[model samples]
Target: MTANNATPPAPPVPSDAVGEGLKAAFRFHPAGVAIITATTDRGPSGLTASSVSSVAIDPAAIMFSVTRATGSAGAILDADSFIVHLIDGEHAELAQNFAVSGAERFTEAQGWTMRETGEPYLPAARVALRCQTLHTVTVGSSVVVIAQVLEVIEGTRGEPVVYLDRAFHSVATA
Candidate 1:
């Protein structure tokens, strides 16, 4: 309250402070892990993402954000379709591999295979959603992608993998 008995105006927040605050807030928020793969002109490209979320049910739409539209992210943005693999704790190594830059990807040991439709698929994932990109919106340095789920491929079920506090964790069921 001010001397006049009126509410005081809030101080303006710096852009960097807002960004850091958001990062800190999300660091404590648990998010599901997903490996997104696509076929590019160079070869197969993929990356681990924690932002995959369902947007619609009837059209089966989903969305995820990429901080940079390069490497696997660039390939995904350029490609018409891609695969979103919902991974579990058993595939944590695979998720880490994709998350790292210049890491060996799509290796035979990783159980990665190309579907006839041309997108890279990971059979080890608990569930794989074949998606066709519907739109992309640029938000600062990040690109938010909205895709339509074309097919749902079910695989072996297990404890789900989540990311929190900068690490991978497995959720135990009751």
Candidate 2:
């Protein structure tokens, strides 16, 4: 068949199926865990994120995606700056608290504090990256945020946590 007359390729797989397949595949893939927090006009907001990744080093940049532009995600998007807490297994409960909608967050018992710049900070994190929002891109149902890491706050070190098979797991030195 000629270029313009060539038969069309088979229909793409339905998004629902593709999504399920993607989730299934990722269930076996381990990802480091982080909790992103920010201060908004209303109050403090944050969420657990497994999508955080380093984008650059010299300039110190990081990228993460929020599935919805509402709740803590919305607050983070609107904030001028935020903190990405690199948490360890000891903070798994805190991670779950942030991940769940309407869960009590920033509670005094959670060891949350406000940074001088006003961003919510977690002193218990293995490391906290204070970042200023640099750019954002909307892709499908997710908003991808790229931020410039302004400062790195070191905290207690322990076994790093990872998300895999819908659960938090600790990684120990081999």
Candidate 3:
């Protein structure tokens, strides 16, 4: 068929079906859970996330997606920096706290603190990555935030918290 050079024809599908079919076709993949935190003028706020991932290494960039309306969103935006706490296997409570909605999320523990900018992060996590926001992109109902690593705190190397198929899994150590 001869093709027009002006524009490409759009593929056709039921509008609402896109969202529904997407959830089914999405094969659940296991991912480590983390609590990303940043300080807000209202106090501190954060949320539990399993979508955090490493994006680049030369500039030490990482990416994580959070819901657009999440309380943590405003705080992270306000501070312009954050700390990603890769929780160890023993931190189910902390995970639950950050996963739930409330004002007490910031005060759940005594040791969570920022490195240089006073952003909140769990001191006892398997790894604590302090990052400054570099870019943001909107996808679906969330925002993909790309951050530049500022510093890192290495703690007890243990089984990190993993989420798979809507449940928690433990990482095996060799």
Q: Each candidate: RMSD to true structure? A: 6.0, 4.7, 4.3
- Sorted by TM-score (best first), the order is 1, 2, 3
Error of 3 at 143 (Å): 1.1
Candidate 1 per-residue C-alpha lDDT over 37-110 given as tens digits, one digit per residue, 9 for 90 to 100: 99978788898999999999989999999977567899999888899999888888889989888778888787
TM of each candidate vs. truth? 0.89, 0.89, 0.83
Error of 3 at 55 (Å): 0.9
Candidate 1 structure, TM-score to reference: 0.89
Give the Cα RMSD of candidate 2: 4.7
* Worst 10-residue lDDT window, candidate 1: 1-10
Error of 1 at 136 (Å): 1.0
| Model 2 lDDT tens row, 1-174 | 234546788778578889899889989999999999998898888899999999999789999999875688999998988999999999998899888877888987889888999988888789999998888888788999999999999999988889998898877779
Candidate 1 accuracy as lDDT:
0.89
Predicted candidate 3 versus true structure: per-residue lDDT over 70-169, tens digit per residue:
6677677668678888887777567777787763565545456555678876777888898998988876677878899988889666666677766778
Clashing pairs in 1: none
Cα deviation in Å at residue 53, candidate 1? 0.8
Clashing pairs in 3: none
